[model samples]
Target: MLARLSTDNRTAFMSGVRDYSPMLMAILSWGLVTGIAMSKSVLTVPQALGMSVLVYAGSSQLAVLPLMAAKLPIWTVLLTASMINVRFAIFSAGLAPHFSYLPFRRRLLLGYFNGDVVYLLFQKKAFATGYVPGKEAYFWGMALSAWAAWQVSSIAGILLASVFPDDWGLALAGTLALVPLIVSAVVGRSVLAAVSVAGLVALVAIDLPYRLALPLAVLAAIGAGSVVDVIADRADLRRIRTARPAAGTADPTGRTGRTGRADLGKES
Candidate 1:
């Protein structure tokens, strides 16, 4: 009995680890970047460490840190963080369908750990397949790995920042770390289009005061992509209607293509 319990525990832990490898890599890179940035910035080592553990949102953290460095007001810092993270509301909505089947406790836990990469991966797979097995386990796996790596690396960065030369460009490491996740989230044309638009807008608006331009760029990109998608959807429906045979129309091959005949053949 003891042996069986031990085996079960090992299997569960191993499963979590196996599923978490990719997330771990991302978190490590992100942590290193955040650590280096924090140490180099005006924030002290303790504050940086605290932010790494408490915030857990990379983009938001990066944004808030700069504001802090600039000696921005607390209200501005909080508002900027909120705006940058508003996308999570959409993420939450997307996960609602899947969460419907889970218990309240599990759903709450999933909400806490559901970042862009993990949520996108799970969303893409969930839509492709009817459902995912071990989704909760996978969520926990990624979350635990990300959380642990982020904390450790950020702390390491604080400790090592002074030792490493300023030329090391630790922030670049975090940016590079984000590439895999961004690439993975690239799904259909609409999503690609939105990303492209966002990039252009951000570049153009980089000089905006108080980072207002950043959020504006994001909104602009989303708007542009959404307009294109709506147009495409309408065009597609028009094409579909034109191609569809009219009611009571007969096929060219002397076969009745009515609902009855179509049902008999089971081809449609």
Candidate 2:
């Protein structure tokens, strides 16, 4: 019986993996670019791998590379990386509900693997509608694929960087990878609008000191999203009110009374 149960669990995990193929592909593409960038940069293979394993943030890695190559002060590198990564605070807030139930150790492990694409995909597909036991395994599967691909690509790029000193224009590879990831993340009008606004703001403010423009763009996106979230929350309350009958003794709409399923879904 124990062996049978183990097989069942494996099957379920495999199902989740199959469900995430497209997302995994997009992640792989992004990982490739990140690897290429790391290889081309000044860092040695071991150092680049260490950053990938420890920091695991594409934007932050990219932002700090130029400064590191220039032999800038440690404070300058620290500030630049910090500004680039401040957006993760908001990402973590948005994802807290889905992950709050996890054990502390597991949560820390998940944090190590999570990235923008992984968070966004899990939000739209798995957590937004409702939680599913074992569904989080799919996220790790996706992350694992991307992580392996990135390491290989980076190593290859580093090896080839010396030979192809002709500048393969490898930096542009990141842009190519980001397009599909952006497409997969689009959920509703509010998110789409936020992306457009943020892109424009970032382009215009690219010259700002200390790379403050990136954070400013992030703030603008957050402000726009918060406004939308507030309006959506009000509408949700109105829905609940109308769904309840005059007496309010029970769930007239069957939503409040039935396992609280309606409330189980995320605010999105």
Candidate 3:
């Protein structure tokens, strides 16, 4: 039993690594930028290292740094970071069903490691195949690979910021890396609608202070996506309802009037 479990875990980890491998470059590029940004920020080395290790959120780290650099109020900085991480709340809810049988502590660990890409890949597979054994392995596989790559890249960037050239264009590299992911995610009508709405909202609200546009765009995208999904589901249900036979979908003899009747002459 133990051997079986061990093999399952190994396979799961490998699957996750294989699936997320293409994304390594993108994540590494982003992490490098984040690391450099933190190193160049007013934060001390220890402070930057602690935030990268402890916070583990590139966006949140970036969000509060400018505020810190400006000597802003503590409450404002906290709020800014909180808003940037609001998507995690949605992720937690979406992933709850997959790990509901596990203890709270285990679930918490999974939540801690879950990233946007992890959530996206897992969700796409889950919806397509429904529940399958060893899902936890897949989850950990993708999450851990991403976490490792991110930490390594960011730490290197932080440590090497002084030596790294500004002309290396890590930021642009990161953006370009995201193109494949963005295209992959835009697959179905509902997803396309959500992305379109979110992009539009972000562009329209780009002037908002404290990076408020991000959360606004997130909310708008959720609303748009939910609306699209609900409409699609209702349409599907309506089609099913219309196609189903009414009350007595049979002749008085208790045979189906349509398909059943056609077979009677041949049977006789």
Candidate 4:
């Protein structure tokens, strides 16, 4: 059996919360909008609260709301929700390496808590310097903090939804919240390529039926990024493969081979 709670774990958990503090503003904003949307929709207060708790999926929830209100087909709603969340699949794959050492159950729980902002922050820190000790602690810290902030803000939004006016332009506020995160995540050429493609695709496909634009955009971005990642990975492998033999040949004498070593010795 594993020790689930330890001093290190507690410390890391708190640290994760602290590291994730700045991004909480964006998260809370989005959650607030999502909660307000849910409360204003056809769903009852209890139903909205239940969805907020059980689904905890702002994008999918929002995506399907208009469809639900318009009495669209059930299949359409389900499909749209699944497609909208396709990006989460990509996020999960990229995140797998960081927590591969953990057990399945623990990893699943962590995945549940690890949403977009936490994933981005963790990815930046982890990929930049490689994994250091206490990374797990940091990961959990960020995850829990994001989770808590989202739940609280959304619940607040839901409760106070009626008091809030529709013309408040909260959607724009939520979009503004994402600006920092979006800028921060675009760190490399590959990421820039992905973002460009996703944006272009989304704009072009904005009127696609069944609300397919979002998922298509996500797929486009993932495809672009994956290609870049593959090319980079292969290049790294080739470089390593070349360096290993060259290092072996050079040996301690700083010569490429036996003849070079002999020449150096003769010169000495």
Against the true structure, candidate 1 has what lDDT?
0.73
Q: Each prediction's Cα lDDT score? A: 0.73, 0.69, 0.87, 0.82
**Candidate number of the best TM-score:** 3
Candidate 2 residue pairs in backbone clash: none
Model 4: weakest 10-residue lDDT segment is 125-134
Q: Please provide TM-scores, in order, for all candidate models, with all chains considered together.
A: 0.76, 0.74, 0.87, 0.82
How well does candidate 3 score on lDDT at residue 75?
93
Model 4 lDDT at residue 212: 88
Q: Give me the candidate number with maximum lDDT.
A: 3
What are the candidates' C-alpha RMSDs? Answer: 5.2, 9.5, 3.9, 4.8
Cα TM-score of candidate 3: 0.87
Task: List the candidate numbers ranked by TM-score, top first.
Answer: 3, 4, 1, 2
Question: For candidate 3, lDDT tens digit of each residue in 32-118?
Answer: 999999999998888888888889988888889889999999999998898889999999999887778788999899988999888
Task: Give me the runs in candidate 2 sitting further than 4 Å from their true place.
Answer: 1-9, 23-33, 126-131, 163-167, 171-174, 232-268
Q: Which residue pairs clash in candidate 4?
A: 16-141
The alpha-carbon lDDT assigned to residue 132 of candidate 2 equals 56
Once superposed on the true structure, which residue ranges of model 1 sit more than 4 Å away at CA? 1-20, 101-108, 127-133, 248-268
* lDDT for 227 (candidate 1): 86
- Score residue 134 of candidate 3 by CA lDDT: 70
lDDT of each residue in 132-239, candidate 2, tens digit only: 565666666555655665656555554554654435554455466567768767677678778878888999999986688899899988787778778889999999
Question: Candidate 3 — which pairs collide?
Answer: none
Per-residue CA lDDT of model 4 for 58-174, tens digit only, reads: 889998999999998899999988888777787888878777777899878877776777878887775433345677777878876777888898898889998888888877887
| TM-score for candidate 2, residues paired by index | 0.74
